[model samples]
Target: MTTSFAQVMIFLGLGIGIIILLTAVFRVHAFFALLIACFVVGLGVQMPVAAIINVTKQGFGHIMQSLGFIIVLGTTLGVVLEHTGSTKVMATYILKRIGEKHAPLAMSITGFIVGLPIFCDSGYIVLSGLNKSLCRRTGISVVIMSVSLATGLYSVHCLIPPHPGAASAATTIGVDFGRLILVGMAVAVPATLVGYGWARYAGRKFNNEEPGQAPVVDLSLPTPSVLLSFLPVIVPILLIGIKSFIGIDANKPVPDWAGLFMVVGDPVIALAIGIIMALLAVRSWKKSTVSNLLQEAVEKAGGILVIIGAGGAFGAILAATQVGQHVSKVVNLQALGIFFPFLLTAVLKTAQGSSTVAIITAASIVQPLLPALGLDSEMGKLLAVLSMGGGSMMLSHANDAYFWVIARFSGLDMRPMLQVYTVASLFMGLITLLMVFILSLFLL
Candidate 1:
């Protein structure tokens, strides 16, 4: 069916709104909620049900085709690092170096670094555990730990290539990975600082400061040698960075013969390699049995698989809505007078909730305009890249899975959660946008 511009707008808005509400308010799992929403839109638009199912599968298939292994490897590796106590060591070491007064800063920095290769969800869980320990020991609030963890994990995940959202957005928008990361980092520091301030203030206000409460840290958990824990997290990022910088598409892939390594050696394999080496480093003071450790990792991987697959399904439904074409037409020079790209991405992110989807959707709509909008020019391209990325950071709420996760783990009520996580996200996005605009002023 040829969806008219107006018709597409109406349906797309309804579809996007419903999916957001369903994901946020009713607390539906985003994957299933989005799946059902896709069905509704396809049917509402008068497409046959059969086509919807096929398209949904096709949507999932496409996401998994590129991202499936990365998600698996990343999550599994994060679990190993967390379970075997590698991340803990790194956090403590950072805390020691920087001091707990700067724990939020430390975690924020860590999140930025780890976010590149690790999935955000896994990174949050792993790093938050360590944050809580430091806070508990040092008399800090959960927000400090939570925000630090979030800032750290979200930084690289949103900005750098290789993370699914960034990678997907980059591929869709035609930005070079090496180049995007360079631009992303320039914007990321300001964003991180913005989130850090939000977290610090929130920490002071709401560190759960009752007269007395049970500690958040589970003291029974054995601490691994900090050196050992550092390796797994560090190695994969180093390898990927090396490939990106020194190799830069020479196809001189990290040698597969190097201990069964492949570009796909994944976070799991990477962490495992690090874990075994860490084990060797100590040789005596071990806590977990191999059987139990592997079992826990597998259990953790199950949730990662489900949530990720569901997100893929939701993305497909949006694609089916053909919102991209409608958005492209509506935002054109003849129509909306060629407004800013940052605003475009922010609106999509707020309206739609999935940053990856928002960025990719916005980029696709914005790409064809590169030439017409002068976006084909170097500064214009940079503006477009940062705008799409920064926009995806806006208005994170119940519509966003990250919002819910932060809400759940940080144990904040919805309103307060919004004040913190949602606002923090907006703060991050705005700072990124401003910096990009300033950069444009100079470059353009």
Candidate 2:
């Protein structure tokens, strides 16, 4: 059954709006809100109501099948890295290079680079914690440092594809991975700079009242090998991009290594590789038993896994309900294609406080409309991904996890945290939008 623009809009708004409203009001998990929205919209639209209901199960199951293991693995590695002080070492290396004179810029770059492969929440768990320690030493407020780190992470996580969120968006819209990376970089650099400017200016205004005090990283911590440290993250990225750009086909057998790449490129597989490799890298088994590090990894991954799974459920329902399609049509009728992706996703992010759901919902809705509008799927997908990133960065207030983390770390009051973290996110996101808009004109 074909979904027309107006009908799509009515259902889409009703469905997505209800989810957003419920998320805000009831504080129900996004996953539940999305599922409810799906049921409501599907029934209202009279879309194979029974079948659509069944499809919801498949949709959520598909996400779990694809991503369950990966989130766990990522969580484990993140926890171990934090406990091991690898984060501190990396920060130490970066801070030394940038020096106190431009540590903020350095943090921004480091955060951006690290965030490309890692999720923003994970990055914050590591970077924000480290940044706060640095703040105490340098007399810099935790607020300034946290914003710098968050800004950096936000740019890469949002703009770059293949970090689960963008990868999901890309698949939904049939976008080429290479195009996302190429075009993403074009937008990312400017976003980084703008975020940097905001962080630095705000940092200076706060005047490091908290004092600079990067806790001396205890080097005795059990660190992993450099190769193992970077392998899983680097390897999968290479595979997806090369395969996408080169157009490897059925006629030619995939090289053995390429097949391995494909296996590892699976989000679940890639992160699992990292988890297993981390065990070896720490030399836990070779030295003796592997209890401490292994257990730590599992523990760390628990919260992240629940949240990710819930996010997946939410996204699945959004697609199943077809509200996204409806909303995109309303957008099309207004000739608002370029901004529709951004505006729609931003509303979700602002109202619901879950960027993952915002990106996923927008991409799913926008996906069904690409051909009808004669639009490039890549354009719509990439825009939707970045738009969610932008909106998520728009306000780092109490609703945001980063808000409390930054406030607690820096020992700053709510008012000042807003000045540094909240405003910096807005500035950087705006710059990112500008870059995306300009590039979309040429690349799309």
TM-score of each: 0.73, 0.81
lDDT per residue for candidate 1 within 1-444, as digits (tens), equals 777777766765676677567755676665566666677677777678888888778766765666555555554565555555565567667778888787778888777766655667766766665665666777777766677678667766666655656665554455655566667876888888888889888667775632222224342446667666666666655554444454344466555454343342433344455545544544444355555655676675555445445455555655666665565656554232224666777787787677765665455456655665656664567567777778788878877777766656656677556777678888898888778777766776
The alpha-carbon lDDT assigned to residue 20 of candidate 1 equals 61
CA error at residue 11 for candidate 1, angstroms: 2.1
Candidate 2 lDDT trough over 10 residues, lowest sum = 211-220
Flag clash pairs in model 1: 24-398, 86-229, 111-152, 111-153, 112-152, 346-391
By TM-score, the best candidate is: 2
Expressed as tens digits, the lDDT of each residue in 1-444 for candidate 2 is 665656655776788788778866778776677777777666665668666667676766765565556555655655555555455456667788789666677677778766765667666666655676566567664556667777787777766654555655665566666567666766777877887777767666676466333334343447665555555445555555665544435477777766656655555565565555555555534332346656765675554444444445545555655554565445453366556666666666666766666676766666655544445555655665565556545555666655665565456777777777777767766776676567567756
What candidate 1 gets wrong by more than 4 Å, as runs, is: 43-51, 114-146, 161-164, 167-186, 201-224, 246-330, 333-386, 397-421, 438-444
Error of 1 at 71 (Å): 0.8
Clashes of 1: 6
